[model samples]
Structure formats: structure tokens, C-alpha cells
Target: MTTQSIKVTIKRGPDGQGAFDVPAHDNQTVLDVVSWVQQNADPTLSYRFACRVGMCGSCAMMVNGVPRWTCRTHISKVIKDGAVTIAPLRNLPVIKDLVVDMDPFFDKWVEAEGVHHGSLTRHDPIAPVDETSATRVEANAGIECINCSVCYAACDTVAGNPDYLGPAALQRAWTLLNDAKDEGRGAILDAVSGSGGCHNCHSIGSCTTYCPNDLDPMSAIAGLKRETTKSFFRRGR
Candidate 1:
């Protein structure tokens, strides 16, 4: 029996597509294929991976036109016609072959006030929190996000508007908004209600659809919209 081979197409910076042939293996991951190409075929190829397990979320990329965790994505699951297309995450500047600039993705966190702001100081004791509280429930929903940027790359709003605070950032802000210990909800709400904030999201739900961690960023964004609108009305009262 003849061993089968697979063709992989990678998107290179400004230049174009780069194709490579690799031997096929059972239960091979997309990351495994990319690593093989880099080690055997092209040594100049550049990409990023840390944990190789899905926990780190650093190895996410576009596989066959959808942003996914390459380390966890099996070739058998995504192979099309004995081929696969690997590309950098979308909605960010490409730095080199299969590498993208993450500065902008993180900057949106500042825009959305995603940072935690608590009134308690180190001198102060940790406040007792009720795990079953509604606010805690809301915060827990989005707390598992690993700053993967996959949801941001998959978001259509981020693709169209450069200033739009992407899904990860806004989802983070929503969680902080509900955090009982956070003292910045008012200011965060103000930021999220601004021009490129939660109101700009069209609720297309692409962010929710593509999140590898199964988070519903669309729901979080909607909560921000409702709360912000209510805050706006209360100020006028």
C-alpha cells in the first residue's frame, strides 16, 4: 500500500501563498503539520506556539478559513480534498509568515477598560464573595477567556472598524462590570458606551460561534448595551 501525502497552503506576508507537501499520519493535528513543514521543508517559516496543548491559546490561527486552536485541531477534522490552508489570525497586521502583530488586539482591552479595578488594597482583607450571586454568575461566564484573540479575529465588526473594541476585550469588560469588587464599572460603562464600544456590535454572533472555549461574547456585549443605555438614561434623570 502506498503511503498518502497531504498538501498544505500557508499564507505568507504581503508576498502570497506558500505550499508544502507533508506525509500523512493518523490523528495528526494542524500544528503537527505546520511543525513538520518548518522542520523538514522550510526552516525560515515563523509561527508561535507555547503549550502545544490547548490551555495556552497561543497557537490559534485560521484553518480552512476559520480561526481555530491549531494545536487542538486535528487534520482529520479539517482536511478538505487532502489539503489544508493555514493562515495567520485575521483582523490584525501580519508580521511575517504565519505570525501577526498582537499589539492592537491587546490595546482594545484598554479601550474597553478590561483591567480589574478594586477598591481593596493589599492592606485590606480579601472581601468575602458569594459564588451564587447573579453578578458572580455573570462574571464566571466569561472569566475563562485566555486572551486568545480568536474571537477578535473572527469578529466581523473588528474587520470592518479598526477602532471597534473586539470581542475578547468587551467580554472582559462585561465581566468586570458585574464584579462586585470592581470599582470601575461606571467608568468602564462610559468607555463601552462610546463610539467604538459595545453599541457598535451588530450582534452577528460570529465571536460566539468561533470561540474555542465556547464563551458567548455576544451575550456579554448585549449586557453592556443594556446597562450602558440604562446608565445614560439615569444621568439625565
Candidate 2:
């Protein structure tokens, strides 16, 4: 009996594709296929992975032209005609084969003021907050993001407007805005109110669609739109 194999085509960073014949197994993931090629075919094959169980979100890549967590993507689900194409995430600089530069993705976070700006000091007593409050509920909606950049790669807005704060950053800003202890809500609103902010989103919902964590970045951006608009008019008042 002939051993079953899967055709793997990996797009190297600016160098073009590297084709390989990888042996297939039951319940094999895309990452497993890549790992086989790297271990058996080409030792130079490059990629990223951590906590392969899906919590880290570092194993994201373009599998068959769709951004996905390779560890979570089973070959059975994605492979077509015994072939799979793998490439680096889009809208970001490719560092090597399947490894894209994440600096631009995270930089948008800084630009969006995604970090928490809390007024509470270590010396200050612990403040009680209602976990079931609407604000907390809203904050929790977008807080599970692991910075995978999958949504960033899938985002059409980021592709059109390079300066547009991508879904993750805007989602982060939304979460921070709803945080009751945050002191930088005003600054965050100002940051996201710019031309490159939440308004740039077309509500295409690609971010919500491709998120490995199943997050709702589109809704978060919508929240930012409403909040920023309110802030704009409040300032006018």
C-alpha cells in the first residue's frame, strides 16, 4: 500500500514557495504538517508557536489564504485535494517563512492608548466594583484578546488605510474606556477619535469572523464609535 502524503506549499518571505510532500496522519493539524516539513524536509523552515493548545495565539498563519491558528486548524478541515498552502500573516512585514513582524500590529495598540491608565495607587485602598455592571460586561467582551494579529491580518481597513488603528487596538481602547478604574479614558477617546481611529472601520466584521478567540472586535469598534461621538458632542457642550 502506498503511504498517504499531503502536498504542502509554504510561501517563504519574498523568496517564493517551497513545496514538500509531508506524510499525513489522523487528526493532524496544519502546524503538525509544517513541523514535519521543517523536521524532515527543510531544517530552515521558520514559524512561531507557543502553548499549542490555543491560549497563546502565537501559531497564527495564513493557511490556504486564510489567517488561522495553525495549532487549532486541523488538516482534515482545511486541506483540499491533499494540499495546503501556508504563508505569513498579511498586512505585516514578513520576517521569514511564516513569521511576520508583529511590531506594527502592537504599535497600533500604543497609538490607540490600549494600555490601562489607572489613577489608583498601591497605597490606595482596594475599590469594590460591580462585576455585573454594564460597564464591566462591556469591558469583558473584548478583554480575551491574546494579540494574535489574526484579525489584523484579516482586516480590510488596515490594508486600505495603513494608519488605521486595527481591530485589536480599537477593541483594547474600548475595553479600557469601560474600565471603571481607568483614568485615561479621556486620552483614549482622543486617541481613537482621530482620522486613523475607530471611524476608519467599515464594519466589514472580518475581525470578528477570523478571531481565533471568537472575540467581537467589530462590536467593540462600534462601541468606540458611539462613545467617541458622545465625547465629541460633550466637548462641544
What's the TM-score of each model vs. the native? Answer: 0.98, 0.97
List clashing residue pairs in candidate 2: none
Over the stretch 29-99, how does candidate 1's per-residue lDDT look in tens digits? 99999999999999999999999989999899999999999999999888888889999999999999889
Question: Which 10-residue window in model 2 sums to the lowest lDDT?
Answer: 1-10
Candidate 1: residue 184 lDDT (0-100): 98
Q: Tell me the tens digit of each residue's lDDT in model 2 across 28-129.
A: 999999899899999999999989899999999999999999999999998888888999999999998889999999999999999989778899999888
lDDT of 1: 0.93
Q: What is the lDDT of residue 55 in candidate 1?
A: 96
Return the clash pairs for model 1, or none.
Answer: none
